[model samples]
Target: MVTKWVLLPVPAQDADSIELDIAERQRKRGEPTSPSAGELSDDELASEMLRRTTFGAFIPWPESALERLAAATTETTRRWSIVMTLCAESPGTLFSTTDISERTELTIGEWRTACRHITPHLRKHYKDAPLWGPGLYEGSTEWPLVTMSGRQLKLRHELHVGITEEQAKRWRAVLNRTTQNVA
Candidate 1:
């Protein structure tokens, strides 16, 4: 039997709430599937609300890569949402040292050092590493997410990060949502 999974970045702090939401989706809100979202377990529903009355944690990276990025420093995990969001929106745009902090919401000088070593490695884990990792562009023509100069932010790659088929699907969903929202 094949199992399906969704790879959303439900932080440990938000997991319980998300589980509650999933249950809510399965039960109370699946009305299109039934009168009470009924008969079928709450999970048997066909319709669910896109905007649940709850908040979801913003997770920029998933487990495998997030750990490595976090380990790069105590900070990458914290700053990635803003950083990745900017890069996803404008790939290959050179943000100077000053620009990164102001535009990307990164604290001043935060990305100055650890970024070079950390950003490039994301390519090892993600083809489109920006969604789930640092959006780094070092202007190497031979590689993806590359630019004409090795400065600024960008993200592009194909998935090669030893993930389950289910995880890949989740990644696809993540990429799609990121693109859709940015567009």
Candidate 2:
């Protein structure tokens, strides 16, 4: 089974409150919130939800989503390490290959090669129904202007393309869970 660790920005102690706050805000705005505020706390809870509730199988790391992701694949190890480092430097914006290379000492060519190596795996595990067009990769734009949504969408399109219906459903569940956690 593929496993991935994601470094959720929400701290364990703050997760519950954040969820509540989001729910309250949604209610006030009359907008729907994906996974109600009472849904999760910490990476363990998120992983439990992903396993017991979604994929019906246990993933290896739950202490921190990033830890699980780190253990999932050697290729992902490099990609996520770079991603986390980029996130640390820039909180909400996307980072291009040049930005990552310049910031992390991975050359632009090296970054592209690493991304290409991991693209198939990311597509296989994380892609859901194409909400948008085909997903975007590092070399799509000028270099440093790709957004998170673009990368994720591209991965999802690659994964779901020609997949069995049942597999798609399961994949969608995983995607939804991820969306919830990120939100």
Among all windows of 10 consecutive residues in model 2, the one with the lowest summed lDDT is 156-165
lDDT of 2 by residue, 1-183 (tens): 222333245678999998888778767766765444344446445433332322222121222333334344666555655554354343333445555666776676766676566545544543331222233433221111122322333322221111222333343444456568879
How many clashing pairs per prediction, in order?
6, 11
Model 1: residues with Cα > 4 Å off, grouped in runs: 1-74, 116-183
Candidate 2 local lDDT, residue 92: 31
Model 1 weakest lDDT span, ten residues long: 46-55
Measured by TM-score, the strongest candidate is: 2
RMSD of each: 17.3, 17.1
The clash tally of candidate 2 reads: 11
